[model samples]
Target: DIKILQLSLRSADLCIESGTLDLSLKILERAAVRVERLEIFSGDDDVPIGRTLSAKYYMLRTLLAWHQTRPDLAEHMLCMIPEEAINNDLQLASELADLCYNVGQQAFSKGQFDLAAKWLEKAAKHNSRSLNAGDENSPNVKLRLIILHMTVRAYLEQNSGESRTKSLQTLEILISYYPNELAVLILWLEVMMKQGNPDHRIFYNRLETLVHVIELTDTNIKIILSYIQKLQEWSIEMCVRTLEQLLLRMPVLSDNEQWIDRLFVISIRLSTSSGVADSLSLLDAVATHLYDYLMKPLSQTTANASLIVRLGINP
Candidate 1:
């Protein structure tokens, strides 16, 4: 049991660093097995130590499994967490919220919009309650709320006509309440584009405001750059699509020379950083496509080259 516990802890640390949720859950299950074995060996006589440990193990295992798969199960387990379990157990509560957030995310990924909404709403409410009760502010809680807003926006994207109008109204409400969430803003831009009725000027203005509000200190820059680099590595197509959307929408953005220059530099850097020849070649092709748009005369250009450049396209 001790060996399994040590293995689980090590795996959890690695998974957390690498974002390997599935592997982490598998290790956690092993730990849970050991905990169960220990409980059985200690006898089911309702001893205080055994019961307490059982509850703790069950909570952790349930949370970990939920993070990997069905969140509803996690929610059920959350209700079982003893009040005594959380008296000084900030870690336990935080873990529960994190699991709930993952459940919401899994539902969103599976396109179970209603279920996703419910789970996310519950997670957000739980986090808020914890915060209001003077629990330490968990960054995970804020992140979950941001994701919930994003999922809500995504759900609205599939509707049409009157339903679309209703979705937009709901999205606007969410945005109004979480105005400072960058992920929400980004998703809102995406939703607007998907609707084919984006207010480009307003969107760009908001993005600009967000960029300014974000600190550009060395540490912040490093983190932002790392994120950009990771995205470039993991999903070049996404980067290209984002650029394409920006170009298609923001006309005045082409006039932003500084932003355009920075984007070009970033693209070049990313292209070179990618060691794979094929990946670099693909990036080059994207650069060329972007260039064609940028070089076109403003009178003839249907898309904004400057915006593309700002998004790390060469053109």
Candidate 2:
């Protein structure tokens, strides 16, 4: 019976190849019935064989749906395909990734961003699974990056705080893997500004450090300035702290004429508009307290130290 089913599957495959989709569909329906029957009587040795047959059956159905231009159905069939089947077959995995990406794009174009993000994330997962050990510059890597970028875009287009938070989480994961990635860093900063959080001073410090390492393009400079503008409006003290931190790193960033000029302009604005001269003492006091807490040893001036010193007199 299994042999008969195998032959039937081959016939169905050939019918599909010969462009007889109707015939192939009929044969596949029969094969699907037989697959269910096989599962019922499947023994230990027949289990893998049964799974292989089921995988082929699902794959053929997916292809048929794709051929008919029914992407929604095709995606459904692909979802039914077992993970073991996909992992064992590179071609199947590639097909899955391609179809998911196309479907995601279609959804994105129709303004269904939530659906788009779902499929795009699927595409990214499958595409990344195929990465080779030394293929950093390979086409697959580039494709994965594009997929992830689109995923983030889809999440952001919803214009809700929840969606922006999702985008930030995605960018955070991306930055962990590609720390010096210019686009990821810029997008991360943009999302931070959109979130309107005043606790982004640490991230600003990180940005200053990144500038010393990665060359800032004009676009990067523009986004950084926009972020600063928003931060200044929201919390001038944070903006001042961030500017001071960047100023400390000026020895390295000063080589960029555009950046240095912008930094000086911002500093002048702070000095002129914000009474930065008067607040210098307050900032200095806060800085000293932080420095002493972080740098100075507690044991040196603690009661424990006095007790230890007095022990020698007692003994």
Candidate 3:
């Protein structure tokens, strides 16, 4: 049965390569069932043939879903494989990574960002082997960078803590590659905010300092403002603290006038969106704070601001 299943897997792969996935799917599904039978005896692991069959089954399932316009399902199928099993098997890792990297590209083309992020993160998790000892300009290396970039884009759309934390390593590598990329810097700020309450000053300081950098163009500023809007929706209190901290740091970082004017621009947009009257607008809170920042800069430091030491103590 093992021999028959192995033969069927090879034939199924040939069918796949020949652009006959219908036939390939049938063969692979049957072979998968047979593989399960073999697994019952081999304890489902570490036996070379059994592991090979199991990996091939899941990998083909992923591909079948990928080519069928079910990228979300493809991602889910791949995640069904145990990370430990994939990590220990080179063939499994490569197949999984390649399938996901391709699926992410297709998802990006269709603007399915959430699905793209899930697959791209899985691709990033594995397949470093192609990049591990190769030329930096190799096709695989370029592909990995492209995946990393798209993963950042997709992660931005979702803005979840788990995805942000999972992406840190690849993101740090990307940041090193594009040191001045504003989007990457924005992602770093979000990660810092979620890292811990004790590190809030560090987040505010980096955000303030980075905004003063030459890369903070109108588009990037808009992106940060949008993030602030989401933060407001997610936690009104944290949003207020962010605005207050940014106002406090603006004076030391650059001309306070410029930052205040930017806030006014953002306030106009927020007003336009909500059609709120001027008397009770969001800017009123900011307006009052603006007065405090201008009139009593040293007197208005919040307890939160005073506690943070601005990158002096690492998070």
| TM-score of every prediction relative to native | 0.41, 0.59, 0.48
Candidate 3 lDDT (Cα, 0 to 1)? 0.63
- Give the alpha carbon lDDT tens digit for every residue of 189-235 in model 3: 66555544425444544455455553444565566666566554444
Worst 10 residues of 2 by lDDT: 306-315
Which of the predicted structures, 2 or 3, would earn the higher TM-score when compared with the native?
A: 2
User: Candidate 2 at 69: error in angstroms?
Assistant: 5.5
Cα RMSD to native, each candidate?
15.4, 12.8, 12.9
Clashing pairs in 2: none
lDDT: which is higher, 1 or 2? Answer: 2
Q: Model 3 off-target regions past 4 Å?
A: 43-46, 128-140, 155-172, 177-315
Q: In model 1, which residue pairs have backbone atoms overlapping below 3 Å?
A: 291-315
What number of clashing residue pairs does each candidate have, in the order they appear? 1, 0, 0
Residue 10 of model 1, lDDT score: 62
Tens-place lDDT per residue, model 1, 1-315, is 544555566666567457677777777666767767766776545444554555566566555656556566666766665656444445555565565567777777878766676666666654544453433365755664565574565457446465467567757766775677666665565566555545555555555444444544445434444434434434554444334333332233436444444554555455545554454455455556656666754332222433443354444
Residue 280 Cα positional deviation in candidate 3, in Å, after optimal superposition: 48
TM-score of 3: 0.48
